[model samples]
Target: MANSIFIPLHAVPSGLNEIIDLIAFGFSDVGRSVPNVYSAKSSDADENWKDNFVFVEDVGSGERCWVSFFETTPDVTGNKEWTWLAGVTARWSWDFAGVVAYALCSYADSIVYNDSGVLTGQEEYSAKDLKGILSRD
Candidate 1:
């Protein structure tokens, strides 16, 4: 029932490549399959959450999540389907909050400060802080 988590990034470690690599590494660290990440073409926008690291958990849940990045600001466009952090955005459409949260933290240097708990009334989460959060269903 929780929606999204926002990881505020100072700057992408290197570029889009690092974002893809760290997310893959982070997912592996969280026990999910390392996902294939690619770029979305501006010429042919699908209007779906594509062109980023995406994966579906096949262990029964089949929950889906996608990552979207922005420089100046994120175009929210009144999309309530996503939970937002601050720097980078990771959206879990159904559940798997801990997995997405863990991956974002991995990107922002193993620890991140977020104000994304508007729906959950939680705040200030870190990578080491996610052990309990990730333990839940």
Candidate 2:
């Protein structure tokens, strides 16, 4: 899986709202009601992937920003179940890989935000900074 970039809904074309809503609903149960809020996509040839735009309001400035997410999967274990080794291990490994990869990418973005809220002037990310983002140490 690749890094999931955060995108604002406003940046999306007028035709893709339904796909965003669908992804949002998949992420949270509350989003289910928003299904069909918009019309169909721009064209039948558009590949609507599991990508979505998020409008995040700045806690201090109240400015809204957008981000996009990709390649997300549902976790049904509820955090307390033991592993079932009876099934194919390859599938389990792939699932875990997606989870870990997403987590690492998110951590990097968080560090980017914390170190430079808007990342206004940073031209390069140092190796040290990269590790710091990975572990937040």
Candidate 3:
């Protein structure tokens, strides 16, 4: 079984394409190359229009991870919200997993959200925090 974690993202300011690119760049910055990355969106009319997902494969070890983003109804504050579901397969080692987690946290921290037509705070996540989250299961 693969070890995985789901991160809830609130008020994501960027679109799916931009997020995907950001994650890819994050991985590259850490020297953990991802040779293949792919994305797809659901075409079924019955499904929510926000349904989209991405898959990333490590260049050297062939380990794989995936991310899925979906929008949720606004809260009482009426701010746009979303969820970021991400995971890595068991094929990855603890060190590699930590590296990936760091990359993810870095990407999350880089996101700047717009609130009430103004760019406000940035997303927050620490690599150490993410590593602790990923170490379970």
Span of 10 residues, lowest total lDDT, candidate 1 = 77-86
lDDT per residue for candidate 3 within 47-96, as digits (tens), equals 33245555666677876666554554445223354343333333454345
Model 3 residue pairs with clashes:
none
Is 1 or 2 the stronger prediction by TM-score? Answer: 1
Please rank every candidate by TM-score, starting with the best. Answer: 1, 3, 2
Alpha-carbon local distance difference test for all models:
0.49, 0.27, 0.46
RMSD of 2: 16.0
Q: Please list all clashing residue pairs in model 2, or write none if there are none.
A: 5-68, 6-67, 6-68, 7-66, 7-67, 7-68, 8-66, 8-67
Tell me the spans in candidate 3 whose CA falls farther than 4 Å from its real position. Answer: 11-16, 42-50, 71-100, 110-125, 128-137
Of models 1 and 3, which has the larger TM-score?
A: 1
Q: Please tell me which predicted candidate would have the highest lDDT against the true structure.
A: 1
- In terms of lDDT, model 2 sits at 0.27
lDDT tens digits by residue: candidate 2, 1-137: 22222211211223345434433332233111221222223453454423433332323333332333343222421122211100101112222222222222232332121222222234233324433333321
TM-score of each: 0.53, 0.23, 0.51
Error of 2 at 37 (Å): 20
**Reference-based lDDT, residue 84, model 3:** 38
Tell me each candidate's RMSD, in Å, in order: 7.8, 16.0, 9.9
